[model samples]
Target chain A: MLVLTEGLVELNVEAKDAEDAIRKAGQLLVNEGLAEARYIDAMVKGFQDIGPYIVVAPNIAFPHARPEAGVIEKGVSIIRLSEPVKFGHPTNDPITLVCALCGVDSKSHIEMLQALATLLRDEDKLKTIMNPEASKQDVLAII
Target chain B: MKIVTVCGMGFGTSLMLLLEIQSIAKGHGFEVNGEAVDLGSAKGMSCDLMVASSEISSELVDEPVEVISINNLLDRNEIEQKVMPAIQKLSKKG
Candidate 1:
């Protein structure tokens, strides 16, 4: 099961820009031994190469790279920025919630996304989690 | 009908799009053969319609398939609004 543990969640983080936000989220996965240090760079470069398509919704940016970029395990790190940052997306810019995803393979990646998508469907729960005052324990209960 | 969801790496965002497309198609009472592919793989593939983020969708302008560019991938309402009509039209022609 994909669970967002205490180690995987950050709240009210201050980031200068989109790259800084992505790095903060990716760093959580690295600290948990879920991915290599290179994974962070790969994700940042992916944004530059691919554009901000990862800004999947209003105020939400899902940053990720290929597994070969160095995913040691299946993990996701969720970070809520203290201030929203622009990602150059047409409409979904000024992102506040950053989800850095890493998976071992195809099946696991989709599985993790499926779970995340379901959780995201709950607007009330998402609001609670997005609140800067929300604790990691509160997030753990929802995800 | 066949549809393709595309993103840069094909593992993350495209897959999320594929799932939403599948569910949306199912909810609309029609079945679609949906697959997710990277931008490189998508060019050579044959499909009736292609859904991708606006950024990646711009690169597909030269392709033969009908391209639908979406701002949000996870918003089902947006997906249904933009994609379902085309799907329904295709269903009627078929």
Candidate 2:
């Protein structure tokens, strides 16, 4: 299972755009040696190539790259932006939460995503995570 | 039944979709084998249904299976609303 420790969560971050938001989220993973710097670029490129489907829900964007890009470990970095930014999606745009995922392989990949999918589906839990005053412990407790 | 979830890289968004698809399938009392595949590999793969974002599903129009395009992947209600009907249609055809 992918344990989302307090180190992986950042609250009320500031970003210039969607790319900046993703980069900041991925940086948390890189800082913990979970992924390399190139993984961040790969995630940004994924958005450019694949579009804003990564914005999986209203005010939330899940950015990730292929494992081959540069995943040193399996983990996730959660960033709650101070302000929302547009990701160009038809419905789910202006993302406030950016969840950057780094998977070492397929099995663990699905495992991690399953956990997150469940967390994202809960409206109340999502409300807490998106709250600006939410501490890292508060966020980790729910995830 | 088999379902394939398609996305650009396969491991990220598509895998998320596959998990929800499997859960929804189970809730509806359907046993399904789910796989997540990249856009490149999904074309040659065979399955009863294909689930993906609207952008990726548009590219899969030529595939043999029923393609269900969803607006939001994490929203189970949207996925169930869109995918269940297609699954029912597929079962009837089979």
Candidate 3:
């Protein structure tokens, strides 16, 4: 079943940097009772400890920690930026979309990741969602 | 054949890529043994192929493993296009 809801969708969000974007996206998972505050902290730290390699696609990023980080439940949340923020990806930069994924184990994360990846393939859908005019139905169409 | 998916940390995107590689490999009429590894560990692990994003993939150019670097890690079409021909070559050899 899909964990993303109208509640988990945030359109035209403001974030100062990649760390802010990661925290904001992770917080949405926490708000929905799927993750903890510590998970959010770990996410920002994960990027800092590792690098900006999480920017999986052009203008898109999936900010997440391991299943053991603080996943209360399996879930996905999204934040569409009002203004693009750089995640320091070498090529795919100025990210406008951030998705946070939390899963209890590797098994569950695969299905969710597949779904997210499918959505990302549609550049038109992503562009539509990035618009300030997008509605709950619009974002839900893909998520 | 064995394939490894790599990321900064193994538990997240790399594992996701491993699952996709497994599924895609099946479609190509071959069974692949898959593992997920961090970029640091992937350098030492022996694998038929290493799939990762452009940034991580570029860093491992000097490694002996064949690299399938994708501009968009989530795009299966891109993944298949870049990876299958190489895997086909390996399959023929095996």
Candidate 4:
């Protein structure tokens, strides 16, 4: 359970679609050395080919690729957008939080998935995380 | 027991729903095996039941699927009230 601080949040972030947002977020991870730079494009392309399913909860998005898709280590990156981003799902308003993940293996990925499930289930906590005024400590504290 | 959870995306909500299903099924004394795949992939996988959001359920047709459309992924009561009955019905059929 690695917590991303400082480098993850992109204020007033803009993207054309869900895939663009993920690509931008992945690039941030690469810049921080949290993941390989090559993974950014592959991760974005993978989701595009598959569909925009990563826009999970109404305001939350988790963009990821399979374990074999150039992940050197297991990691998680959090990005809080100052404004919401759309993924074309009418029920989903707009994404306020983006959790970009890379798992080393399926077992670890499952554990990570479970933890994420629990976190997103909490509406109050999700609101706290999505707040741009909230610090890294506040985001980590909620999780 | 085999279970499949569906959401708009295979990566997020469906995965989360599967976790809750696994936890509930485990408590109910069932040995469960679950996975989260996109609604499109549901046609290819064989499972005892399929749990999905109400929006996704409308698109599915002509499968032996026992579809449970959850209103909210975080609501355990909704899962119990809506999803559990569908699973039970499927279990009895098998």
Task: Highest TM-score: give the candidate number.
Answer: 1
Comparison by DockQ, 1 against 2, better one: 1
TM-score of chain B of each: 0.95, 0.90, 0.93, 0.84
Ranking by DockQ: 1, 3, 2, 4
- Report the TM-score measured on chain A for model 2: 0.95
Worst 10 residues of 4 chain B by lDDT: B54-63
RMSD of each: 1.5, 2.1, 1.9, 3.2
Q: Which is the winner by DockQ between candidate 1 and candidate 3? A: 1
Instruction: Give the candidate number with the greatest DockQ.
Output: 1
Best by lDDT: 1
Chain B in candidate 2 has what TM-score?
Answer: 0.90
TM values, all candidates:
0.94, 0.89, 0.91, 0.80
Restricting to chain A, the TM-score for each candidate equals 0.96, 0.95, 0.93, 0.83
* Model 1 C-alpha lDDT per residue in residues A1-143, reported as the tens digit of each score: 67778899999899999999999999999999999999999999999987887887788888988898999999999999999999998777799999999988988888887777777778988889788788888888878
Task: State the DockQ of every prediction.
Answer: 0.71, 0.58, 0.67, 0.37
Hey, what RMSD does candidate 3 come out at? 1.9
lDDT of 2 at A117: 78
Candidate 4 versus the native: TM-score? 0.80
Q: Which residue pairs clash within candidate 4? A: A53-B9
Tens digits of per-residue lDDT for model 4 on A69-117?
A: 6777777777776667776554665877777887777666666766776
lDDT of 1 by residue, B15-59 (tens): 779778888889989888988898989996888999988878888
Encode model 3's per-residue lDDT on B4-78: one tens digit a residue: 888988877887777777888789887888889898888878888888878788878987879888778877888
* lDDT at residue B40 of model 3 (Cα atoms): 87
